[model samples]
Target: MEIVTGMKKITFGVFLLLLLSSFKLEASNYTFGVRIVGKGKPMILIPGLKGSADTYNDVVAHYKDHYTCYVITLAGFAGQPASAELNHPLKGQRDEIIRYIIEKRLHKPVLVGFSFGGTLAIWIASTRPDLIGALIELDGVPFDAGIEKNHVNMDSIRRDARFRNEKIIDAQADYWQHVDSVRHTKKFREQGFLDMKELVTDTTRINQILDWDDLSDYKASRLMVNEMNSLDLRDSVSKISSPILVLGSWKGWVNFKTKETVAARYQKQYSPADKVTIVFSENGKHFLMYDDFNWMIGEMDKFLKSI
Candidate 1:
């Protein structure tokens, strides 16, 4: 019966190997806070800064029947735990996403990102073009307007990034204080602490925002902004080969004045692309997907089908 015992041991070893593989998969998914739903071709959605995977509920609902949606909320955002090892969280996020795609054996799935997440998506597409089939950027550009206007050299960029990194601790403290005030004090709410115009009218959206506002990790947000403000993606845009769809906002918020100006800026910035499509939303704010849902959905559907 020695031969029978040998076979049993081999089978047990195979079972152990499979168990370890399953644990690794679960750990990776948990670390990235990825929530997958639906079944079909893979579709990855990355939410904006301080935003959660819940932000893409509407989009997932629309495409769930046809696509398996992978909604990612980066670590330390939207109440998720922060990673102590990640000094440059956005870069970490990009690397983790690439790893996830590889581990899951996704076949160049469509990647859709909003705001800061869109910036990450752009970086991923540029750096790892083979990992994605198509890309959709919702109100995200390749270069920082401030850095571009000042014509800052690489040394200055490094200096500015360092300065920002040094100030992160104070910024985090101040942000947490503000968050606490908004959460606890009615006076702070009356002082117009939060901008309501940016939020959609839907109850579900409002509730999601409320939940996010309550639990957002300020430290992660600061790290993301520090990296984002210092990034210059002008050189990387030309490296991307996949189909790109940029949904730009016409209603400018801080510095931008008019729709024509905003449109012109994007036209100039993304003009280097050989396979890029730019769509300007007349009424869309920074959150174009929520602000102009029907139009955005239509465009996304058409783009997905085309790609």
Candidate 2:
């Protein structure tokens, strides 16, 4: 009887191992750096410009036990080799994400995006609402008509593209020099561009940021931004039917007289959405996740639970 019981226990252990191996195999098929961790409901995390799958390390750590996180590192960013097929990165990224979700059989997975990633998330949810269950935008907004309102002419597009190309060249040349200067300095932290204080204090996060900075494809980044500058998505936002939670930053630098003005701006910007909830992080900067982590986690948890 003891020998029979031991054999049964060994068989169960082998079955568990095979199940875990199958899950890993399924996740490995994605071309993008899709790091799947933890367990339970599916959650997709898209990082900001020049960010990698690990960009949401803190957030993933917090929710790993409760959710299976699909952290994606886009082509040409986060040290991943640029895909030649991605001629138009913005649209290409959206399509790739949709394909990934379908291929993986992820049902109603919550989408979380930060910065440029958040903007892409909005595009995905607007265009393919069926693929996502809900969305959380962290310091990202739809296109503003004001940027291209005056530059509708072809000449303006040509000029802007040329200018951006030159800027990209300059950025590539000085990228490492800038990285070295900011790697251990306090000057960058003082500028408040990305809540650098939080970055500098966290060595792992700081190193990850710098690593991506060193390997980033500046030309691709600039090209995507230049193309995006010519498009507006106000109408697209109106078409989205999925529930959305937008957490915007209200730092006083963007010609805002008060926090109320900033809040009003975001509310008006996202008003077209039928089901949207907007919140502002008064004390946080662009990297709100790092600046107000506890608040972000609490809000995200609440939003996820509700959905």
Candidate 3:
């Protein structure tokens, strides 16, 4: 009886150690705070503004067994110290990601972005085409629409900028809450419904916005503005040598009636059978990744497999 009890204790200790080891392995495996899984064609996934890399678990799980998946969380978004500032803008964030890929030596990975993330992916492809193998945009403006043209009005843009700035200071306000309010989190396994109030309390969100301040948006907005002001892709749709797939919500751009319309109208700019393929989902909204993830995943699968 004594021998049997000792053996049982030994087994239990081994089980505990194994469980701890497994947890450590999983945590340590995700180097660079980027969660990577599966095995096949390498694919890099970029999340929307203030989004988490972990949100892609469902989508990544579906394809990880067949494709290597890399989910990136922008520096400030994931509790990392903000090396940049509020006025730094989106271009800084994009360049940071571009440098990360180059430094990591990820070869020709399929570049996928959601919302603002889509904008980043497009910028990378446009600027660093050789680094990207295939481009997949989910519910975002595909090309750079000159900032002036895209904004409702200079007054509105400045007002919005001010509002955003104030929210950055509070960090616990619902600045980004409305973004996820319409999203479907049931399928996405999010931490919660992303209540605007709750979002203000979120440490990750607070730190990112506070650290980056207006820099991320300012830079991105201007880079896009310059692209529109000087180098317009309107005529060079055919020049985008990289394989591209664009996705949008079902209501098209009519639902927003204002700000979001620019996003929808841009789709028509591209020909259906052209190098770029535009797909619409009846159930998705600005946060299409959460609204209709299955549909998005299906399209991603089809696109990745084809190219």
Best by lDDT: 1
**Candidate 1 local lDDT, 202-298, one digit each (tens):** 4455556656855776666777788887777877888889999998876634466777777777777777777999998877666776788889989
Ranking of all candidate structures by their lDDT, best first: 1, 2, 3
Q: Give the TM-score ranking, best first.
A: 1, 2, 3
lDDT of 3 by residue, 31-113 (tens): 22477789987888987665667657677878888778988876545443333435434556667667767876888888888
Off by over 4 Å in 2: 1-31, 144-208, 252-257
Clashes of each: 0, 0, 14
Error of 3 at 136 (Å): 0.5
For residue 273, give model 3's deviation from the true position in Å. 12
Candidate 1 lDDT (Cα, 0 to 1) = 0.78
- Record all residue pairs in model 2 with backbone atoms less than 3 Å apart, i.e. clashing: none
| Per-model TM values vs. the true structure | 0.83, 0.74, 0.59
Which regions in candidate 1 have their CA more than 4 angstroms from the true location? Answer: 1-25, 28-30, 146-157, 169-184, 187-207
Mind giving the per-residue lDDT tens digits that candidate 2 earns over 217-261? 655666666655655565688877778998877662354547776
Q: Considering every candidate listed, which one attains the maximal TM-score?
A: 1
In candidate 3 the C-alpha lDDT for residue 245 amounts to 89
Candidate 3 residue spans exceeding 4 A from truth: 1-32, 143-239, 252-264, 268-274
